[model samples]
Target: MNEPAAPAAPETLEVPVAALRPSLEAVLMVADQPLDSVSLASVVGHPVETVVAALQLLAEEYDEQDRGFELRHVAGGWRYYTREAYAAVVEQLVLEGQQARLTQAALETLAVVAYQQPVSRARVSAVRGVNVDGVMRTLLTRGLVQEAGQDAETGANLYRTTRYFLERIGVSSLDELPELAPYLPEMDDLEDELERVGGLPRTPDAVQDHPAVEPMTDSQETP
Candidate 1:
């Protein structure tokens, strides 16, 4: 008997480095969402370091070639996306007629939310000098702000910027917010306003008390 055809040697599967890089790139490119380094490593059957190195190399290659896309770390993971330079073109094509633009009022309300986050709608309205009920709703629907929690005293809803806000602003954290000194009024004007208001009340020496201001709700209409 012909030695049973010598049990066909187990097929050896070899993945080339060049092919592996593109394979990884394709996976990241087509993914509908970001993929963590660990997940990518597992899928590629390689170490996390190897996956990261590959990602960096791919990013560099794209940059060197002036590709319209590159790898980005966003929302706690990595993904391939087009460069911002082509945002207008891509947005026009992808969004088509479905894109919604923010009104000036909405932008102002959003600014208030970004700087004084965890703030109530009342405070935001107070600062903007307009009813923010509709604007806040729009921002919420657009995923820019979210309800953080209710205030203990008034049970009013507190609002804060969402991760979408950070991503849109291209900031990794709130601390990266640009300084607003140039836009703000002078300290003397603020002090003068405080003086005009007969100065803020000072706490008693023994009983340190906090005011029971009503919690601000993003949903409430300015009455």
Candidate 2:
């Protein structure tokens, strides 16, 4: 009686294994955002404690090696960013002539995109309590925001902050944005999102006279 080889042990059981630090680096390299230790552990099939230790060790190694990029923690996760010492070169190479600072409205929209990414334009507008169509268009044109994909339920295109957003902001990850980040609503809660945006300083026309809205500089660097 041949038992068909136990169905090859089912596909889900197979897990990829590799050296810890390299594995972490490989995943972080392509990640659009930082990854928490447990998340990294799951991907690398290691214990969370071991992954955390490895991340610290790797950070030390980069510091010793004077690597152009370094492993960093931000936005409640681990990710990589170019070392600040090299920021000048990277800015020259990557940024070049593109120099337009973010407007208060754009900055608000970007913040919304950062916190509630993979979010829809309608959702963003609903949160901002204004027609964000024009602001979103500006974000798209500026390359600070990108299309993440479509929502399964709504089929509306979802937006996420781009790597350029991280770069310009000089953050290793979204976690580095600031401590206030924890206050942002979780990405899935629409009612909370609406309430969250509604809580922001409103002017009957959403974008005016808001405290978070900083004055745009004269140069207008395309941040």
Candidate 3:
């Protein structure tokens, strides 16, 4: 009849607009790690410059409002952190929960990993005088430790503390770890123990004496 009314003009294709700032907040609220601006721009459907300016504005607003948490640029991305004034409150709560949740053995095993990183579970067991397979698994599950690499000789997986580990302990780098680290078994001592236990010897330079990458300082605390 009337040329089918010209296909009804496609109904204007209404697309609901998402509010920029609230959208940014929603995405950041659930992020476990810092998110870079470019990644954020893609997710929020905004230009990179716009997204970055919005983030800076939000951070400033939070600071002006004296919010309990603040947005910070760290580790090449943006993340939220507890306000410095309220850190002790958060720290006490976190520490109390940690005390109840992590067992004495788990704590001990974690300490071993933190100080003797790039070490194997077998080496941990050798130092603790007990099998650490189960405890090491728990640490890995909690995101406190990660696999570094495999032993060149024995082919066993080496373990190390994660950046998250440094964050929890309020340290920026492994060098900030307490003096007790020196008191732990040295690499040579551990190697000798491995030899006694019938494990193959590792090359002199197979594992690094320090963390391969120093963890960046988080917003709230530092060593």
Number of the predicted model whose lDDT against the real structure is largest: 3
In model 1, the clashing pairs are 120-216
* Candidate rank order under TM-score: 1, 2, 3
The Cα error of candidate 1 at residue 190, in Å, is 4.6
In model 2, the worst 10-residue window by lDDT is 208-217
Instruction: Quote the lDDT for 144 in model 3.
Output: 86
Pairs clashing in candidate 3? Answer: none
Candidate with the greatest TM-score versus the true structure: 1
Which candidate, 1 or 3, has the higher lDDT?
A: 3
- Give the per-residue lDDT digits (tens) of candidate 1, residues 1-223: 5565666888654434475696697788667569998998899888777677777777788899889998888887789888888999977865542256677787888998899788777666655545576778778767889999976876767899999889988999999998878897776664343233323233333112232232344454421
Model 2: per-residue Cα lDDT over 1-223, one tens digit each: 8666555554442222337767888899878578998899999888887788788878888999999999899999998999999988987865543575667877887887888787877666656656566677777767788898987866777899988889988987887767654775554463444445544433334332222212222333322
Looking at model 1, which ten-residue stretch has the lowest summed lDDT? 205-214
Q: Give candidate 2's TM-score.
A: 0.42
Q: How much RMSD separates candidate 2 from the native structure?
A: 15.7
Give the lDDT of residue 126 in candidate 2. 56
Off by over 4 Å in 3: 1-18, 102-223
Tell me model 2's lDDT, rounded to 2 decimals. Answer: 0.71
lDDT of 3: 0.73
